[model samples]
Target: MTATSSPLFRPLQLGPLNLPSRIVMAPMTRARSSQPGDVPNALMAQYYAQRASAGLIVTEASQVSRQGQGYSFTPGIYSDAQVEGWRRVTEAVHAEGGRIVLQLWHVGRMSHASFHADGLPVAPSAIAPQAQVWVAGDDGVGRMVDSPVPRALSVPDIAAVVGDFRRAAANAMRAGFDGVEIHGANGYLIDQFLRTTSNQRTDAYTGATLEGRTRFALEVAAAVASEAGAERTGMRLAPFITQRGMDCPEIIPTILHLARQLDATGLAYLHLVEADWADAPQIPESFRAALRQAYQGRLIVAGGYDATRASQVLSDGFADLVAFGRPFIANPDLPRRLAHGLPLAAFDPKALFGGAAQGYSDYAPYEAVAEATA
Candidate 1:
């Protein structure tokens, strides 16, 4: 079958945004932001613009505040400079006729003392994930370091974090983003609160019940939606991955509950990040059916999806869009390559983060590669 006939090539409506195709560029942490302030730069803008052929582009996770930062050189959305820096990125993608959204993030327990002023990361509870975060040395080289136990957030502190999300959503709009995506996946702050094993709080925020465990995530969704307009708001969730010691069975039910609530909020879409690794567990069909029944919004699934699998899911009516992660990273013209069955370029693991244009914007388009070979 030709690319034109594939379901993945069909156009879809995400709230007010009209996507040209079902292929989305998933949000990834490149850690290539300008140093000293964790601000977005022209090089990052160029990188995103080069991949503008995607139907939708979710920007790399940006810290909601300095306190929310975990890795080195990851851009932030809280500061004035950060907002202005992101403006360049949005403008670049917009000029290329691509829609872009800013992903608001707060890394809870997955952080180190160097990234914090109080020398302590914060979470729903004072538990350590034994996770590692990338921190930069004085020489500007990045390295993975062990995460420390985080301080449990107090009632007031929880409210403050919600406020930070609201402010960050507003900042994204000021920075020229078409919308905002709440980063609730990948064992981040919201994910920590959602999983029962990580949140042992007795307060209303983590009130112990399934509803209580999900309160923080729902509150964040509501706050971000209110700030960005529900139609322009989207969120990402990972229900399968057991990272950061968060392998609780109750998480699936918690996600289903959030799904129902999010559907009612009239949000643009819900992004699900599947466990793509070879050894990772596959998402059950029962759970997928349950999610489809619970949520009525646009659904996007990502995780090692090649052309055939993407088409199968879309044709089966299981998902409205398909997001490609590493494929999009290595091939800037990923949509074209997938459509035409062109050979893909491999990504350099070493140049994945905190680097210049060597492995980033320098990835040649298929035509360039063809020309060089010819």
Candidate 2:
């Protein structure tokens, strides 16, 4: 592709914000936060500001409430300190000419009992998965612990969860975020309600129908849209990922149904998290075509996309934007490197999560590398 016609470099309008490129920095969980409050700090601000060249940046998944937390050291948006801490991050990114949104997250059944005061996590049903959640001890060390069976959320409890999401979105706005992305994927609370294996209730939430199963996601989206305008609201969905005993066959139709509902609600975008692992299941062209017919808003597809693959999808006219996860983790100037065919710096897995500057904000840019080598 010629420089003038390169799809990745083209500008696009996403809600009230206009982006300079089609490459979005996907949100990844890097558990480097203040220990006591799980708060965003100046180091996190430096990490985000380093990647300001992307079309947009979505911050890491943040818990809406104390009960929503699943991993140790992950930040939260519900508290006053968190809001103040996030304000520094937003300011840093804006000073670097970047647009950023916060992702609101709730782990639900994926959470461990240690996070809850009553020693029980809540979900759409009382079933437990064979998954593990990260928890921290008094020494501030994170360890993977088995997830226990969760208590079925009462109808009132479900309403309260929805309220938590709404309040989180409002808090995100107050924290100076451009918008909020509802975390409805990765076998979380909303995904638990969406899948049959995780959710086996006989109530309206999990009956023998798709509408009943999808009610929780739609309600959460509506509540978030109510707090943050629908135009500024986005959601991430993984229709193909089948982890934590969530490989349900009925998820395709249910996703289509939710897509149509989100379309009618005027949602800004739908970020689809395709499988990132090697030899992962391929999402058929038929499903992509069907999704296009179902949803009328912008579509962002993530998971293991390089420059050539991103160009192919954008050239095919199915995806509007492409999100790069781990690449952005190491290569802060990812869009520039893709545009110029520069060599990428490999990231060390040891410093991926819950670490200091070694693997977090200390990755030097390409210019520094060339200077040091010269």
Count of steric clashes across candidates, in order? 0, 0
- Which stretches of model 1 miss by more than 4 angstroms? none
Candidate 2 off by > 4 Å = none
| lDDT value, candidate 1, whole model | 0.91
Q: List the residue pairs that clash in candidate 1.
A: none
Query: 1-374, model 1: which lDDT tens digit per residue?
Result: 67889998888889889999999999999999887799999999999999999999998999998889999999999989999999999999999999999999999998999988889999999999878999988888888899998999998999999999999999999999999999999989999999888899988867378789888888999999888999999899999979778888898989999999889888888999999988999788899889999999989999999999999988888899999888988899999999999999999988988889998889989999889999
Q: Candidate 2 — which pairs collide?
A: none
lDDT of 2 by residue, 6-111 (tens): 8988999999989999999999999988968889999999999999899999999999999999888999999999999999999999999999999999999898
TM-scores of the models, in the order given: 0.99, 0.98
- lDDT of each structure? 0.91, 0.91
Highest TM-score, which number?
A: 1
